[model samples]
Target: MTDLRELQFYATPEHPCSYLPRRQAKTLFVDPSAELDQCNYSLLSDLGFRRSGPHIYRPHCEGCSACISARIPVNLFRPNRGQRRVLRRNQDLEMRISEPHFSEELYQLYRRYITARHADGDMYPPSPEQFDSFLIRSNHHTRFYQLHHHERLVAVAVMDQLDQGLSAIYTFFEPEMAHRSLGQYAILRQIEITREHNHPFLYLGYWIRGCQKMAYKTNYRPIQLLINGQWVHCGD
Candidate 1:
């Protein structure tokens, strides 16, 4: 058996929960520059963390079922009719997955995406420093995928590589490119990447049954839920 490891997670005092209505929220994060191996990721994923930059975090709360870890079986995955259309729509775009780096254009598009999609939201305008600290500071198995539409940055996705799967940290896209359904396209691309790499799963973090912001992830069929510390297939 692989030996367990330890890491520190820091968080705020308390704040209103984003996913669960009327509930408080808090986050405890470890330094992205810290050592994190495949075994560490396996343990953390089991603990309910998705991934962000190099940090692993789950919803730490007094009481809440609003957050659950989710993943897609890459081997059995298939692009539905709609997903195919999204792929077709983004055929002209180019994707590059590499070490995380902040760019002005990427930041500008991210700001627009936040303002247009979540203006009234808590993380409306993430400062440049915050964005850097959130994504580029990681020293572990973290990567950023940038999608370019004919040399113009259109979308970006931060992810973590684990022994069994890939975890999508967060994604942002140009608001004007909404018609392309970049979000779904990104997830599909990740599935393809995961499959090519022989990874069995694509961790999507959570699937809140009623949250519109999170429900889109569930559209990917043949997902597995980590319930009671066991992987439960939603279809079978």
Candidate 2:
């Protein structure tokens, strides 16, 4: 519904791929100060661009196209036996939608998670400043969905409400609770929330084949991959 040409985009210099080590990656991003209007942002998402804090961007590699944008058609989703267990086990979790802001509890959990799991990635050694800039919402459309257990905050999922669907931007939880598979639970809960709002798709961001970090995404069966500007069912 918005004119694509009315906005400007800048592609970043090639950097090492975060998902695929041997390959380099580039990104195309919009000028947040100039062209980050809600209309333009919505269109960018339809074109497969995702947001990290304030920057709305998508992979723009020249030779490699491993980073494929993926989404779940909520109406078509069927949780497997394992996923169903994840739901029933997490039935006691309390979910709340709130404004995007800084919280000591969330920050502590984020630090612990990154320190234990993603120390080798770009966001290694998380700090308060990095936490604020990477997870905080700048354009003002992001909503923080917090999951609590027995009144103790356990997980937080950042979601962006888009024109076509709800974008599951990022999530972090208590690293010690790894047995509960909090990451998978977060997605399932988001899907239920999407269904309640009548959203057709639940954007799951980019899924790179051969990346163990991204392998879990495939478990959400019947997902659609955006390839060559067309969406094809992964199940097909």
Candidate 3:
């Protein structure tokens, strides 16, 4: 049996629940490292684990069903016309996938993304140290991609490489590019990248129904959900 103690957990201060009407939510996660390979990470992910702050987390509540693991099956994905448009619109943008790096320009874009789209949200105005703590720490094979426009940083996404596919941990983009639908663009790009790499799926952390912010995930037809310890196809 695996030693559960090897996993670490963190506590969150009491705050309003992001999911339910009156639910209090917290996360249990593991500090990720480049050493943690896809096979091991899959074990944790199957148990509802999500990475944030160098940690992989799963909902740990006495009673809760709000958080559910969701992923996109690249083999089954069929981009809708609108999704195709979003991809086409940003074709000029260049994607650079490399080891995670820190930059003032990227930080500035991150700050703008948080302030404009998530000002009151949990991840607001994180200091450079905090940012480094979150992005720089990883277990297993980890990588991040930055979207550049004319050599300017416009967006960034952090991903964990598991044996089967790529897991998208988090992403942020310039608020002024909202019309470009940067959030959706990021996911679509990940799928394309996964396909290029000949990977099977793209793990999109979690998709909480009823949350407007998360509802967009449904638009990506041909998704799969980890239900009752299995992945079931979510038809288009």
- lDDT (0 to 1) per candidate: 0.79, 0.87, 0.77
Instruction: Give lDDT tens digits, candidate 3, residues 36-86.
Output: 556767777766677775566677654677667888888888888998899
- Give the true-structure RMSD of model 1: 2.6
Which has the greatest TM-score? 2
Instruction: Give the Cα error of residue 225 in candidate 1, in Å.
Output: 1.3
* lDDT of candidate 2 over 35-143, digit per residue (tens): 4666676667767888998888888999888888889999899999999999998999999899888988889989998998899999998999998999885684789
| Segments in model 3 whose C-alpha atoms lie over 4 Å from true places | 1-15, 30-36
Question: Could you give candidate 1's per-residue lDDT for residues 100-183 as a string of tens digits?
Answer: 788888778777888899877777677787688777876567888999988888999888878887878888898886799999
Supply the global lDDT for candidate 3.
Answer: 0.77
**What is the TM-score of each predicted model, taking all chains together?**
0.89, 0.95, 0.89
**Cα lDDT for residue 184, candidate 1:** 95
Query: What are the root-mean-square deviations of the candidates from the true structure over C-alphas?
Result: 2.6, 1.5, 2.8
Residue clash pairs of candidate 2: none
